[model samples]
Target chain A: MGKRVGIEVSIAIADAVKLARADVIAAYPITPQTHIVEHLSEIVANGELDAEFITVESEHAAMSCCCGSSAAGARTYTATSSQGLALMSEILYHPGPMRLPIVMTVANRALAAPISIWNDHQDIMAQRDIGWIQTFAENGQEAVDLTLHAFRVAEDRKVSLPMIVNIDGFTLSHVIEPIVIPDQEEVDAYLPAFKPRVRLDVKKPVTMGPVGIPEVYTEAKMAHNEAIKASKRVILQGWKEFAEIFGREYNPVETYRSEDAEVLLVTMGSISETAMSAVDAMRDKGASVGLVRIRLWRPFPGPEFRKAAGKASVLAVIDRCLPPGAVCGPVGAELRSLFYKMPGAPKIFSFVAGLGGRDVTVERFEEIVDKARAYAKKRPTELYEVIGVREI
Target chain B: MAQIDAIVGWKDLPFGCHVYEPGSTAKFRTGDWRSQRPVLDKEKCIKCGMCWVFCPDMCYSQTEEGYFEANMEYCKGCGICAHECPKDAITMVPEED
Candidate 1:
């Protein structure tokens, strides 16, 4: 057991990486994600952590370096946000099929055209199909816990995939919160030393990332797809082991007051906490409303999500990112596709609420619920509704 | 056809972007794609090793008597060896196919 200390979430994440005993860290500085790698550099410089801290010139190079390090059988890590993540996109798709279990932290931030450094899901949402296992943390504590869990799941022999833990940019990354910083011994017990099933070694050389001609390309992709899907079991196992050791339970799709509710608000990332507060307020007003937070995004946990939201009559899916020109926002569109063929599926109302760090207050959530109820009562209309946009 | 059949099933292929054997490109036999081949004139050879250095595929190797010869197993007959040979000991000729 370790003492509960109040620290910034970025520092807590750096501490988690240190506890996990990552062997290599290659990162480029970017807003909101800078503090995490800065603290990690300090730890490495102070000799508290024995790791190779590479200060790369760009996010592209940082991810490339991480790929090289992880392929060389070193437990590797990196952190980025917004444009840094976008810049790394070129090399981001390499680690998954290469089966390098490198863990990264993504401080979710808004993409720039007008250039705002703030919290949003647009950054991570744009990278949804890169073949990495993705998870969202609603608060600072989960950010710390999931950082540790990301390594455990990624390094599992069955999973052998890369993973990203997304924490909302200024909201969760810069905020101070009380978190339990687990001791090294407990973390060592929970996450064993990473033993790569295959690696680049001089004594036993093996070719990795070889060109896949057309004959084998589809098979290669199929193998990568099946690996990520099968990783759901390993993820659950890691969370189960984490609960036994830390006494904090986690699920792929976690529900709040959704056991008996007619209207459900679905959210990911830090907005889930605010949505939960809104759920409490609505419950006080004798409204059967609840919250469903998607903690795991990749390999989507479709069965778990279906079971959790199946009983609801009306589902309001609040998307933080605006998928322009699409029928609905990204998360909402995904949910619609998932529930379209489902038996007795709830009437899903897609709402794009927060974009570019726009505040999604409890009042906004209440309004979302009201609009969903209204749409459910009326005839079926548009596929999605963009809320909070001022008429200009 | 047997080789193609072996890889048609998912179980036969290596999992997840792997090349199970190191240096397995040797088995590809790129010489089959060659249209022009470099013939070495051993009588006029000075063995400056320029052909070996300039070979795009590095297919030229030193012989026991210190003369350069193409391995032909992986050479694509690019003719860089013939073009770059300082001693004029190599000439590119059309292959019989």
Candidate 2:
């Protein structure tokens, strides 16, 4: 195990990318996510990392450059936040179907309208169905670990799908933490050189992103859909291998003292750490409460999630994003539909919290559990409740 | 005549539906979608190559006699060549008649 050193999460993520030895870094700096690519650029300038860091004009251009370099058989890396991710949304859908295994870090932040730059799931949830493999980091170490894991799984020949590692903006990105920086030899053994399954070449050329006419459009989308769904296997295998090489092990759904709990608190991103502390507090008070932290977001980890939250009588689910005019937040709706008609299913109480970087403190978690328990007995008329919003 | 008539199902598509063969467009004849064909009048032809330079599909090429001829296989008959001809050397006519 390498020595754990104190470093900002963004810098740690950049070092992780360097350890992976990315061939190209194309990105437009955005708030919160800026430090990640900023460090990357400096590394390239100092000859510490032999990579081309293309400073693109806009997020759209950044993603466009990523597509081009990745298609030309280069291991690509980039980072973006809320609006930056929103801008890259258009071209973001390309890399997955094209099978260019580009790894990106998203400093999760709230979207604009009210113009707040803080940590939230709103940014990532907005682009939720972009067809890239997405995973959440509960803290700085997970942020660093997931960055390396993203590269490994994404570049797997059978699972050549782009991946996004979502780290909470100020919570994880800006915070300083003691993280074990793996040795260069260790990372090299863990993640080998990228070998593109199909790449653009002059001598023997292949036309990528050709016009998909009505004849083949449906079939083309189906193939991409199947490939991404199949990538779940490789995603799990990646963490397993990482544990063998490194000491830490990661899972799709992580549990905390929920073995015999009656109520479970569900959360994602960095706040999951807070939820764990709250679970410990609840257990001290003789409350049958546990916590479930979902690490894998895209493939949804249906089987593992069901196994973790199945025994609970109530699930106090927290979502940082509030999708306006919708029945419930994204995570809420997913669970509702997942357990919709199952026999003896747990009553799920969806609560949207921590919007615009408001802290989901341990106290707030206890409140969510109390509400979930109350609502379990008498269901609330509202589809989901947005907690911590002050009302007159 | 080279249009791809037989489209494969989902299971049979090449990975990402990528075309492995270079210049695979050569096998596709888009002319079938055209309603009109370009008629070149050699009598008025000055070989200025305006038609060759203006064709959207690059269908016009200079023949051995220094006259531009349209390769009917790929032309969609958009009439940019006929419209841009300096000497009125090219005109579009209904393909049916």
- Write out the backbone clash pairs for model 2: none
Q: How far is candidate 1 from the true structure (C-alpha RMSD, Å)?
A: 3.8
Per residue, candidate 1 scores C-alpha lDDT tens digits across B68-88 of 888877678898888878778
Per-residue CA lDDT of candidate 1, range A143-244, in tens?
A: 999999999999998999999999999899999999999988899999999999998888887888997756677888888998899999999999999999
Best-performing candidate as measured by TM-score: 2
TM-score of 2: 0.90
Task: List iRMS for all predictions.
Answer: 2.8, 3.1
Over B1-97, each residue of candidate 2 has an lDDT whose tens digit, in order, gives 3377446788898887789876766666667888999998999989999998988888888889999988988899899988998899888999998
Worst 10 residues of 1 chain A by lDDT: A211-220
**What are the TM-scores, per candidate, against the unseen true structure?**
0.88, 0.90
Q: Which candidate's DockQ is highest?
A: 2
